[model samples]
Target: MDVEYLHHGVPLADYQLTKADRRRQDEAAQVHEWVQRQLAKAPPWSEERWERMRQLLGPPVPPWELQRWQLRLYCGHVVEATRSRERPRPDGGVCDEERCPECGMDPAVIVAFEPPANNHSPKSSRFARRPPSDRRSKAELVAENNALRAELKSLRGQA
Candidate 1:
């Protein structure tokens, strides 16, 4: 791949980010936050464990709050255990599936990927369309259920 295609006219060393570039970075951060919020609300169910999750990740955390200091915590155990005599991903590094930090389950079934960040308030399709995160937290689920019920009643009235 040609590096010039990516850098453009700016010299490799003189790559000072412009205001527009900064704004784009900000936008990306916002979108990522939105995605995380959605995931937190509607964590994927584990068919094997048959449990909501081993533990809750607590209230939503915006990436902006963490800044770059934030480290990508891979799932439980190293992908490989120690470099050993000869191993591809020595020292239990991240695996392909990316399991949990606590439990060694590929994709974790709990932790999920963040979505493209945006400044505008992010709305989950599940909630907007059918409230996929109905029963995440008890309080929120109740609120969602109530809203759904109200909508159903209103629709019935029209009918």
Candidate 2:
């Protein structure tokens, strides 16, 4: 038997990822774990339960997971991070003016809330549909629309 070494997209080899890709993958894993935990808490889903879960998990970070940005500070208060314009200093050096607007920390400390490895469900989905607990059902809405149309017809006839 002969040994072959392949470098370009070959199988049985570790692939390299860029910094951005690695960051995105890590973020996705964290968000997935958080979502799974939240979902588990609201099992046998309902609209109210789903909404509560959404509030607890926050909004989806977008493009990958369903979670919100929870900015934690050293003071133990939760806040949001925003981009700010650079300010010019006396030495003509530019500084990042971005900070926690709530606490006004020059360099806002970021605290990530990553769920533990065992908290995630391997068979879960990234997105979930709303449960059948909304106030108005589709059939009810359709019947109400028909009733309104009939009432409008009667009013037009009287006019």
Candidate 2 is scored at a TM of 0.26
Off by over 4 Å in 1: 1-6, 47-159
- Each candidate structure's TM-score, on Cα atoms with residue i matched to residue i, is 0.26, 0.26
Clashes of each: 17, 2
Best by lDDT: 2
Candidate 1 lDDT, 99-138, residue by residue in tens: 3355643342111122122211113222223345443778
In candidate 2, stretches whose alpha carbon ends up further than 4 angstroms from where it belongs are 1-72, 75-79, 82-107, 110-131, 135-138
> What lDDT tens digits, residue by residue, belong to model 2 across residues 1-108?
111211121121233434644464455456656887998897597799879988999864553232223334333344433211121111112321125567664443
The alpha-carbon lDDT assigned to residue 43 of candidate 2 equals 50
Which pairs of residues clash in candidate 2, taking residues 3 or more apart in a chain or in different chains?
Answer: 59-67, 60-67
